[model samples]
Every structure is written in C-alpha cells, then in structure tokens.
Target: MVFDAPPATASHSWMPSSPCGPACIEPIDEIGTARTLARLAGVIGLVLSFPVLTAATPKARREHMQRRYARTALRCLGLRLRIVDHRHEPVDGFAAPDTGVLVVAGHIGWADVLALAAVQPVGFVARADMVDWPVLGTLAKLTRVIPIERARLRELPGVVDRIARRLADGQRVAVFPEGTTWCGRAYGSLRPALFQAAIDTATPVQPVRLRYLDGDGNPCTVPAFVGTDTFGDSARRVLRSKGMTVEIVLEPRQWPGTDRRDLARRCADAVRGTDPSRHGLLDTEWIAAGSTRVQDPSVGERGPIRRTVMATRW
Candidate 1:
C-alpha cells in the first residue's frame, strides 16, 4: 500500500458520508501478536542499552530510541503518520526546549494516539483498566504512563497530581480532553476541566489537530470511536480499509496565564477552525463562543477494546 503526503495548503474539504474509493485494508491481524513480541523485544533492547541512554546527562540516546520504538510500533500496525510543521526547531546549537508541554490533541480515531506517539517521548493518560493488558501494559509503564480511573471521578484529582508531577519533571503529558474518540467528521467539545492540572502548573498546552486520509491522500474514512469498534475489528478494517494517512498539525502552545476555559476555547477553535460543523457532530455549547465544556457522546460506550497499545515514532 502507498501513502501520500498532505498538501502545503492548510484548509481541506470535509468528506461526505459516501463510501470512500476502493478499500485498501490489509489483513494485519498478525500485527497484534507481532506487536506484542516487538514490545517485549523493545523492553529487552532498552535493558541492554540502559548504559548508553544513561551515559549522557539527559539520556538523549535512550529517549531517542523510545521515540523510535513508538514510530516502529505504529508502522508495524500498518498505520502511516505524517507530521506537519513542528512547533519549534533546534537553533544556535541548542535543542528545542521541553517546557513540559501539556499536549492537548483532538481525539478522533484510536489510531490517533499512534500518530501522536510518532512525534516525541510523551506521557499518555490512559484508563486504569488498561494496565492488565499484555505487552502494552508493560510498555506503558516503561513510558511513565499515567493511568486514570475513569469510573470514579473522585480519583481524578490524584491522577491530575501525578500528571502535574510528571510535567514538573519535564515530561510532555498528552491528554485526550474530549475524553473520548470519534470520526474526523465529529468531535466532542474540549473538556476544560482536563486542563486543570496544566493550569495549576502553569504549563503551556500545545494543541494538535489530526485528519486521516486515504492511500490517494483523500479523506477515506474518519478514524473514530474505537471502543465501539473492537481493536481486532478496527485493525482488520484499517488494513483492508485502505492505506490511511494521518495529518497532524501542532499549533502554538497556549500559555498558562490565560483562563482555563478560554484556553480550551482557543484550542477548540484552533483545531476546528471556523467550521465547527465539519466535524460530523459538535456539542451544542461547543459552537458557542467561549464555551469550554464539551459534551461527550460516548461516555458509557465502553467495549472490549480497552487496552492502550504503544506506537514508536512513525
């Protein structure tokens, strides 16, 4: 299968509900088993190379491999990633500063996480139940993954504290504040409450937008709502679905000084652009200016696909 790069143009036409061209899904059912083995291998690799990663003050070597692991895992799963422009680039012999970015990205398809992992060493906030999975659980721990108890709202403060602690340690924390995933055609409004930790820590919230394209680079199908779609099923659909290309554009970070609600609004506007309707569906309050609380359409729509798989930088 071939993948096409997104154009230089920023704007794109929203795809209609018609069936996308020829489905190019491949039979990647073997990826699940392959990925499990790869994750185990990566763990072994990390153990053997521990000395090299720690030889430097920042362990740049080890972190570099972690990014590579993320990308490779995604590629192995048949996911193609395309990072648009970076937020910052190295300058004057200095590397890009890690301000403990609180990365707030649009949650669309389950594959979206893979695309995000392809970029940097990120700390993912996942559901607590995912910890019991196979190799994915082990990898998440290695990546300093912070698991949250979605069923109990009271435990969230502690989870936020942990996330803040990681941020203080200079780790980029990624959260799907929409709290759920959907197709590219629709999105749950930004949940400003999820930003409480970043707000408290005064960390910059870096917003990112993701769009999936077909092998021809056209919008094929919106990768959305994985819980409703089992991983095995989703993987099969994706493999046979066609070579999907994901477009990820990172926006400027929103400083902590701004109101959390305003920050969320700005981010929603940034990701959604002028058309709130393009995303197949939007919360009623989401389209209203300055509303940060987004309505989640699938709060209780959990299914069997509860595991959080890791992806190397693709």
Candidate 2:
C-alpha cells in the first residue's frame, strides 16, 4: 500500500533530499516464483507468530525472541546478514548492558530496522505512523519503538528527552540521524538533534554502517524503500532478489563530548567511512572489495580493526 508522504514544512528544512530513484536500483539475479512464494509465506507466518510469542514472555527472553525473529525474517527474504565489528570490546549473545548505548546508522530502507535488530535487538526511534501499520504496527508496539512525528517539529525535544531517559535506564536505543532513507549507494548527513540524547546522558554513540550487497559482494539497491515506493514495492523486490546480503559494519563507539553537532559529525564520519564524496557515498570499487577504512578524527583514531561475524541461518 502506498503511504502518504508527510507534508513538508520549514521545520524539515534541515532534512536532505536525494537524487536517487528507481533508476538507481541495479539489476540483480532473482529467485524463481516458487521460491519467492515460499519466502513470502515464511515471512507471513513469522509476522503472525511474533505478537503471540512475545505477549507473555519476560523482558530478557522477549529480547532474545525478537533477535531470533528478525534474523529469521531476513532469511525468509533470501538475505544473509554479515557483521563486521571494529570495536575494541565486543560481546557475544544477547545481553542488556549495564550502561546504555545510542546506536546510530545510515538509513537505507525498512529492512534496515530488521537487520539492526537481528544483530543486537534494540529499541528504535521510528516515524510515528509506523505504529498504525497493520501487523508491523503491532510488532512495532511490541518492540517499544519511540515514535516521532516528523510534521510536528515542536515535539522533537520531548522525543529527545524520552531517548535520554531510556539511556539513563541502561537501555540500548537506535536512531537513524539522517531522518530519512537513502539508496545504499548514497546517504545523507547525520542530523544532530538526536545526538543530544547521548550527550545528555553521557552515553557512547555506536555508529553502524549498513550496506545491501549481491552475492558477489557488489552493491544492491533492490531493497531501497525510497521516493514514492510503497511497502509492498520494496518487499517484492527483496523477496525475489537472490543472494542478497545485508552487511553491518560496527564502528568504534564514540563517547559523547559536550557538543551534539560535533558528536553527530564524528558518528557520521565513522558511518560514511573516509569516502571524500558529496553525501558521503562510497566508491563503488572500494565497496566491492568488501573493505573500507573508518576513522574518527575527534578521537585521533586511525581506523577500526575488522572482525567478521557470520550469523548462522536457522
């Protein structure tokens, strides 16, 4: 179903506009009709089961089930999840941290949400309308997503305060600072407002780089849910795509300094890598090689150490 685009206002002036459209999506190998149908069936079953499974579960077990459900959802879409960690300390398994972390990433599509949750299930800062979306809406409520009304700019501070409270309570929260989606090929600048939450709580900001790649490790834009494309449009493209992989690169966590703008820039630099291009788009050649160097200038850090975690498919 086609979703109504939020009306533009002066408050949204800071939001970036992309030149990307349907033409940006590269042609890729696709699975057959039968396989695609089966994948769709699998996804439907999982979506239907999600609320029932988590309705009565405790917080800890519920989180575990959420991660499992997310990973399974990706698999059903014929996608593989590959995680590259650059942090000094990385933990295994799904465990809530003693302290909270602000997880930031470049927004690509709706699948970006599932991919992040699959790695480490965390609450999200999503568009308010998402809570009203059918089955997905129920799932959103179950995950406790923090909804922000883009049209109501005045409510942003309240949203920021809510994020800060979550962090203070030692809960990991994720936000796409760009405030919109981009094709995997290019991305917009990270907006500074949400970074204030991390600053207020003195929490570390985790910058994650997400990419959709084909089987041969080349960029794939088939999954991009941008422009006027409906949810069904994106879902069909993803389900039919073959050997599509979602690559998640975890950059070193940046400790919040006093300035939220500076912190946003640093986190943006980490997510965008050292690519010296407008909109921070990576060089196609570098992306295909499956490598990129992310350096945080504020911390005088050179680059992150590469650690790959190949998630086992269930």
Candidate 3:
C-alpha cells in the first residue's frame, strides 16, 4: 500500500451528519484477526532497529527514520491519514526552533498519537504507565517523550516544567488537552498550564482535530481504546475493520495571551464540528439559544456522499 503526503488544499466534501449522539459505537468482530496480526508483525520487524539507529545516527537522519517508522507502521496497519488545513500550508518539520510550536489535539485513542507522529515528529505528553509498555515504552523514552505520573498530582508541575523546557529547547510538543480520553463526539477542556508555556515563550498553539472513519465515511468505532478495551483488543479491532481513514483538521491556530479556558472552549467547539471561522458562535451555544442550525456561510455546498464520513465544518 502507498501513502500520500498531506494535500496542499483543504477540502472536506465529506461532511458528517450532525454530530451523532454522545454514545460512540465500538465494533467487536473477529473477522480480520489474521490480517491484523500479519500487519503487526511487519511493523515490529521494521521498527526493531529504531533504538539502535536513534542512538547511532545523526540528529536529522534519526528524526527522518522515526517518521518513516511511523508512516510505515500506519500503512502496514491499513490506516489512511487525510489532513485538511484551511491555510493549505505544508506540514512543518521540527528541524530546530527558538521556542518550538505547541500542538494540541483531541484525545481519541493511542493510535491517534501514531497518526500524528506520521505527519510530523512531535514529542508528546504520555502517561507514566507507558514506561512499562514493552517495545513501545522503550521507544518512547528513546525518542524523548515527556511522561506524566498521573497518580501523583505534585508530579504534574515537574512534568509541566519538563514540557516547558522541551519547548524552550526547540522541540514541537503535542498534548491531549482533555487530560483524559473519551469518544470522539464529546471533548474535555484544554489544560490551561501548558497553554501558558506558549504564552511565556511567545510560541504559537496549533489545534489539530483527528477523527477515524471508514471508507463509507461513517465514524469507525472499532479502534477506540476506551473502557475495558486492551491494547491488543484495539489493535485487532482496527485490523479486522474493512479499512480505516483518519481526517485531520488543522484549525486556525492562535498565539498565547488568549484566555486558557476560552482557548480550550474554542478548540473543543472546532473539534466538535462547530468551526469558529465560518460559524459565529459554537453550534451548541446556538442550539441552546434556540437556533436549530448555525447557518453555514453560503459558499461551496458539497453534495452528500453515499453514507460518507463528515469532515468538520471547513
């Protein structure tokens, strides 16, 4: 299978049905176990040497390999990533920066990290438990991912400090502001402290919303790593599904100085499909205010797809 770099234009003709009920569908079928395992094996074989190369190779070459590792892993897993940027700008590489860009995204599953890593190499805020994850944990440490000890609240400050230092050192860092995971429909607040780091450094905050879907366009729930779901189980679910595609929307990013709570709300609203650019207020706010639908700016009206997935209002 072949993978394409993000397209130059941002066009989401596949509009989703008004955000579905808060309940996310989780598919549990044993149909594609063999194929999934086969794909997993291929990815493992390709990445087994990552640790060795990371230490031995030069900085630029090492980062290149890491990205190739992610892209190759996604392809082997049969997940297609489609990125839509309203600005239509190309993805940026973390070559070096005075204060790196702070990237925030909605948390869906662990796979979400892999998909984003495929697009650009960003150091992420991971949980402490990941340190015990076999190959993955080791790789995360080698790649310089910042870990947070969720159990000890005091440790958070240290984690934040580390994240700030990472940013100061010119590394693009990705964080899931919800502070937790849930179905794709609903979202939690974007933690405020991290946003402050951007403010201190005068760096930009880019919000990228990610949703996994099927070729038919409906949201794909098979891969959600939610309650009672094991890593193995989620991997099998993804492998068994007909096929999976990821829709990544690069929202209009804002700089620091914006209220953290307000920024979080704006990010949530956009990720939830009520784009602030075209719509006046959040869709929910409008709905609660007694309006059924926030009138979309009369521009390009795309015909509905045959049971297709909805890309956020773009």
Candidate 4:
C-alpha cells in the first residue's frame, strides 16, 4: 500500500526541510530473505493483536503493554534500542507520574514514535494525517495522540492549548519540535511553537537525542523518511537492514522559564550536542549539575557526571 505525501503548504513557508535523502544512506548488512519474511510476519502478528492486547486493560497495564509492544516491534524490525540517561535523578525511562514533562527529540522517521513509546508510553504530537494510516492509525487512537495540522496555521494555538492542558494535568507528552523528519546523519532546528506548552505550564523540557547506528557503531541513515520517500519505502529499507540500533540519549532536563525561544534553542543544542552544521556522529558528553552519578546501561556502569555549562533559568 502506498501513502501519498502531504502537499506542500504555500502559506506555511516556515516548514522545516532537510538536504539528506537516499544518497545519504549507507548500505548495511541485511538479514536473510527468510529471516526478513519472518520478521515481517512477526510485525503483522503484533499489529493485528495490538487491540486485543490493549482492549479493556487498565491505564497502567495498558501502558505496560504498549511498552512491550513497542520494544517487540523494534526487535521484529531488527533494531536494538540503547538508552543513555544523563539526568541527575534518572526516572525509569522518562515516565514521572507526579509531574509532567515535555519530551522533545530530533525527528528521524516513523519509527521514532515507537522508540520513545518503547522507553515510556507517552502521548505524541503527531501529524493529523497519521490518524488515517492503516494499522498505525489504530495505534495512534489507542495512544490518544494530539494531532496537529501543519497546513492550518491558525489552528496551532488550539493544539498548543491542548498540549498545555495535558501537561498541566501531569501527563507526559512527546513532540518533535523540528516540525519535520530528517535523515539520521543531520537534523533540523527545533521550532519554538511547541515549547510554548512547557513554558505555559512551567514544565521541564526533556531533550532526547535519537540516532540510528550500524553494527560497527557508525551513524546509519537507512531508516530516514526524508525527501520524497513514502512510508513504504522507508519500511522496506528498515526491514532488510541488520544490526540497526536506535540510540536514545536522554539529556538533562531544562526547566521552562518565561522564554520559549530560549528553551527551544537550549533543547536543540542539547540534542545536536554541537554545531548543527556538523555531520557524522556526535561525541556527546553526558553533562549534568550536582554530584549524582549518571548511569550508562550500554557500558554497564555508573560514572561521575560533569557539570553542564548550559545556562538554566530555573
């Protein structure tokens, strides 16, 4: 099945764009055809059983099921998830019930939503058309994602208000502030619009750095759904790739001050780890204030955390 790309909005000139495309992708080792077919079957089975698994389950249990489903889905697609926590007090996988936090990340592709949910089941600010997609549409509804219409600029405030309400009620909500997807090798700037919700509710902003890596631990752009590529195109590429790892670096949380632009820029800087112009893998040092030891599960140990030089308003 083919999904048509959204038409370019003539009036929405601020929509983010990226120069990375299929050419930016590096060929990686692929699983055998039989294995690929088996993985595809696994994915189909999971998608078909999702509703039955989630149906009538309590909120906590449903979230547990969602996390398992997301991890299983990634495994079915031959992707491994590596989470790096840099927070002073590391909450279990981005879920904090007492208070709400706005999770922001560098947009990669459709799989990004799955990766975040795998860590902690959180509602997403997604494109309005995502609710109409095939099996994913059902998943979107189950998660109660907040849909945003890019073409309708006037409706943005309403979307922001909805997100603010969710945050105010102490519900974790994730959003890709870049406003568009980019190849894993490069990313776009974080638009300040969504940051308003965090500022409005005085919620801390969680900046997550997401990247795809090959078996050799180099950046991989095979999963990017950028340019004119359709969802099917990206999916086929991912299904064929082997030893693909989704590295999620949960950076320090920035408290929302009175400036959304500053918050957006600080979050972007944290995600990018350096100048946005630089390509290739970023050597991000997990920096945080205080003496709390940060843990790196990938390395299987805890280490001293360096103080972050980024100015914090609160």
The best candidate by TM-score is 4
The digit string of per-residue lDDT tens for model 2 on 1-314 reads: 22443312224543334434555567699889999999999988998888788887787677777788999999998999998888777464222455688999988888898999998888999988787664457778888999987667778899999999999999889998877676777666677889999999998888998889998998788888766666767778998999989999888889999998789889988998875332223223222111222221123332432323221110
TM-score-sorted candidate list, best first: 4, 2, 3, 1
Put down candidate 4 lDDT per residue, 1-314, tens digits, no spaces.
22655322324444444444455566799888999899989988998898888886786677777888999999999999999998888588785665798999988888999999998989999988887766567788888999988767778899999999999999899999767676676565677888999999999988998988899998888988765677677777999999999999999999999989888889988988863443332235422211112222223232332222322221
For residues 184-214, could you state the per-residue lDDT of candidate 3 as single tens digits?
Answer: 5444345565566666666677788788887
Clashing pairs in 3: 15-310, 16-310, 217-308, 217-309
lDDT of 2 at 58: 89
Better of 1 and 3 by TM-score: 3
TM-score of each: 0.67, 0.83, 0.74, 0.84
Task: Report the lDDT tens digits of candidate 1 across residue range 1-314.
Answer: 11211111112121111111112121222335555555446544654553454455365456566667667666654567887764564421111446577888876555665577777767798756444544344556566678865545566678878878877777788887765454555455676666777888888777887777766776545354333344444544554343657787876667767476777888887777765533222223222212222222344332221222222110
Every candidate's lDDT: 0.56, 0.75, 0.60, 0.77
lDDT of 3 at 210: 85
> After TM-score superposition, what is the CA distance of residue 138 in candidate 4 from its true location, in Å?
1.9
Off by over 4 Å in 1: 1-58, 86-98, 278-314
Stretches of candidate 2 exceeding 4 Å from the true structure: 1-12, 56-58, 93-98, 276-314
Q: Return the lDDT, model 1, position 8.
A: 15
